[model samples]
Target: MTAPSAAHKPVRKSRAVKTLGFRIAALLVISIVVVVGLATLAARLVFHKPVDPEAVAPVARQIHILITLAERDPQAAREAGADVRDEPARGRVDPKASRFLKDMLAYTGRATDATVIREPNSPVLVASVRLKEGNWLVLSALDFSPPNVWPGFVAWIVLIVAGSGAISVLAAIKVTRPLRIIEEAVESVGPNGELPHIREDVGGNEVRATARALNRLSVRLKAAIESRMRLVAAAGHDLRTPMTRMRLRAEFLPEEERGRWLSDLEELDQIADSAISLVREESVSGDAETVALAPLLESLVADIAAADLPVTLGRVEEVDVCVGPLALRRALTNLIVNAATHGGGASVTLDIIESQAVIRILDEGPGIPESLIDQIFEPFFRVDLARRKTIPGAGLGMLIAREIIERLAGTITIENRDPRGLRQTISFPIAGVADGLLSAQDVECT
Candidate 1:
């Protein structure tokens, strides 16, 4: 198979990259992760101190009262479950608990450092502080269990994450909305020669810049295409005057020479007329209307049959499509004439398949070569080398037909039929509610 044009090749490769929506979502997810990570880091910095004053306050107050009692009366302090010992307790001191106990002693105006330990197999916290009499007073209280902050911390974290995610999604939507509009506008451009412009003031700087660029490009492209069509039309019209003068001058020649020159002039005239017609077909700007496929095909076949052409209509279905009636008829006529002149005879069929209207034109002549099938759609491309002594043509029939079909958001393809001939299939999307439906009275041929 032949490679696609450079324009289409880029599009195929572009599919490998991430789409705008996915990219935006990824960016938002990463942003949320980073933001949440930073928030967690800040929380750790502010709350990670080993000694918390509020957590150790109640335990410290009780220890201070017991110490006061021991300093006043040692026997009464012992009866009150406070023990004055000469040596430190045989237990491992928790550094965090010890730091908290030191802060507690300082807050209670005691000028001594205390050793805090967790008794084995007990929830009691013990602390040893030196008394004024040079004895270590062992103070004990139920362990100060700080309130569990994990559940509340987790709840706050969840809330923050969810809120951030929602905001990120909104931000992504805000960023991508204009891009989506631009994409729709670009895709809406068709062979109909209409280029829609997008709003440049609706998005961010980059999006607005892109919209402006696209608008300028659309305007330039439309102007260029129109200029080309005008040049073709003018060129075709200018040739007619010369051809007429040549025909007039040929009348003065010898009879034999006159016939030969006129025949050649007539062929030239036909080519010029075909070129003009092709240009006009391409420039067709009719609004799309609901047309019945069955009646249109029947009318075309009738016209061909009136010309004594071997054209048959078969399997006509009542399918409706939104298209320019005049352009569609002209395009179909070109295909039918091509089939009859080159393929010898033509058979037209219409059917509704998978919500699409399929129009097939089959002919009983030698089919085109597989290698040159795509080339035939190019303007003025001819398969004369393969056909040998085929009828003369300006080679714009298939090109005009394809342009018309594509303008109607349809596709036309040619394939070789088994045994002999070519099968040209044209498929159009079925008219939806937006295109509107046609009543019986509105089903006339153009």
Candidate 2:
């Protein structure tokens, strides 16, 4: 078999254990153990009161006298309360008491394998020593017992656990810092669809890298948008010269054909105007304030009805939204005109649902085809080709309306109404909320 080539060799992935998060997690766990150990050591040093060697010095002297007395007079030593035993000693051992007694006994020329054990049943210390004749000399006393230090040990444990918890929380926050930054940046998007500026120099390596990437994307998007607007505006300006010349030439056509020629020229003029209007909606930004929906809806209906067009105001709620008043009015006017022109008549209504101020415009005209519904927002998209000359639109109304609404930080959705009409809905984030109770306003169909 041929040796595997370097290109064919599986790439070695960096181990998860080597990641920053894993290291932080490992350090956090390791820190808990270290803290516990330190707390235990601190407790021992601060709270544990060991038996002082001096405190048991008398016990040592008593054991030495008992051993000497036992060597000569076993009965007198018994009278001195020295318990004599032939078996090995029992109970727990006291190292401090044992060490003190050993040094004292060795000084008096009585060095022996001795131990001091406390009785299992009482608060007592017992000193044990083996005599030269193989007998065990034992003495018990109450003065050598030590104080309880368990309470101090418990306190240290509590402090260690609390400190470990705090460290864990800090590690979690640090790990999620990038995510928090992303969420905050998205939430702070302004009414003009402008993203909040991100600082690249701050934060950890991962966070700084994310911020840099987002800032680059934002810069690229702004450049693309500006380029598109410039191209549209320049194209619109170039078309006006030709359109003016066409209009002048159409004025000289034969009397029978002059009307039709002028009508086509007028349609061309409207298209240029619509294109420029779309560009304005994309590039213009400033002077945003809360505009109420009720008065705006009423005024639009009145104007359209006065023009002898089929338009009506339906239930309008007194609600406000943050947006540029003129920009908002222009967007709504386009939608209302589109609905009234395409759908025989338009009925507009405004209501507040949840924290959103919703506007619904219903028209009785034949709705758009289901197959072409998604393309309705595309610029210059027309579903009914036969009506292109019959209707007076450049097919830019829906696109412009959508652009304006979205730039104002709102949403629009169009769906076919069940029986025979189209429903266009626009939603905006309500500002300076009114009580949930909608205002009572009766409006008749025009």
Candidate 3:
């Protein structure tokens, strides 16, 4: 095999870096916002008090005006609703006014009362204390101006979280959307299909690199497919001359000899046909459609039966698959024909398993040799080369089946029945329209 060109191999890259960049950028933005919000909350709870005890106290101390005015006249103190006590004091000062003055003087002993004349509205500060006059003296002291700034602070927090969430969502879509597009484009290339081209216009550098890689792979793949097709065509053309001569010579031989020679020529023709089909199956360019796999299997069985083959189809119904209908039908026919030719008959079953349509064909003849089981999938490989003379099979059937199945994004696995024969299982994906028709008894492949 020739080494792939530079265009085919392209430069290798790790997608994790681009993915990590998007994640880190989005996370950093979100983290900063979260930190600021938390810091703001912490500062509010730690540094900003709910209600300042100092500010409230000064406001309560404005009652000092009435106390001082009541000190002047005895009748005036009583009439003005100032404290009137049942006690005597020096001078004509009202007894209640003298007591009130004494209490105010005692209350101001530890705290200040200097601004009374300079600022009457000066807020007061009062502490819990025992008063000799039986009433508490509450001093009010106030700052000329105090700041009230909390509502605006709270609004800032709400905005941060909402903004962070919105940014993260947009970032995730920016990253995931392009990746999904790449995925769909990759899926477009089946085992037989050509790879797609990478368009630089679709995304940034990372996406451009990916598209370039896909385009490179496409070129290499096209070359490989063309090579295989050429080989198949060459082989078919080369064998036709010998096959024609053998058929012509067989006409002049004894009846029994002619039968044997004719059968040999027929087998050669089958082999050539199988080679052509196998090459075609491998060089696909993703032309597939939804198909009802069960009905396809049933039809193959019916055809085999019409040809007088002893084939029994069990429960072939309602299993849909997405694939090339003609290619899948050919693959199934190859498998069924293989079983009929080698095992004399086949028991076929079709059903859905784990979102896949699975078709199984079992033969009651001696099972495949354990040693050759793996090699059986290789083109033109047979368990016993001598059996080719008697079996009338080209041995390319299973190989063709596998190639087609894989091209459809399915799989084919083989095993042996305990003491009897070979069991082959073909599984294909059910999706899109194929899945939608799952409820239908008979799905028509479009």
TM-score winner among the candidates?
1
| Per-residue lDDT over 29-107 for candidate 1, one digit per residue giving the tens place of the 0 to 100 score | 7677677767876877788665566776776777787778888898999887788888767698877767767777788
Question: What lDDT does the true structure give each of the candidates?
Answer: 0.75, 0.75, 0.64
> Root-mean-square deviation of each candidate, in angstroms?
9.8, 14.4, 12.0
Q: After superposition, how far is residue 204 of candidate 2 from its true place, in Å?
A: 1.1
lDDT of 1 at 107: 83
The number of clashing residue pairs in model 3 is: 17
> TM-score for every candidate vs. truth?
0.64, 0.57, 0.52
Candidate 2 lDDT trough over 10 residues, lowest sum: 437-446
For residues 1-446, what per-residue lDDT tens digits would candidate 3 score against the true structure? 12123223323244754576578567857786879978987886699654434444433344444444444553685576554443321122223323333344445432322222112343332122222443332332233332445677668866876777677766665666556545545545545556545565767666677777767877988798788789887898789998898888889999979987888789889989878767666654234666777667777898999998889988766866667778778888888888887887899998877777788899988888888789888878887788977766777888888887775667899988888998998887675634332211112234
Writing each residue's lDDT as its tens digit, candidate 2 over 1-446 gives 12122222222333442365556765776678687778777866888676665665665666677788888888888887777888547877888767766766776566887787877777666777889788888766454444556787678667766777678767866886776666555554433344546888888899998888777766887778778888988898899999889888988889989899888878888888999998887666535576778998899789888988899898988987876678788889999998898899999999989989999999998898899899999988988788887888788988888877876667899999989899999998786442221111101111
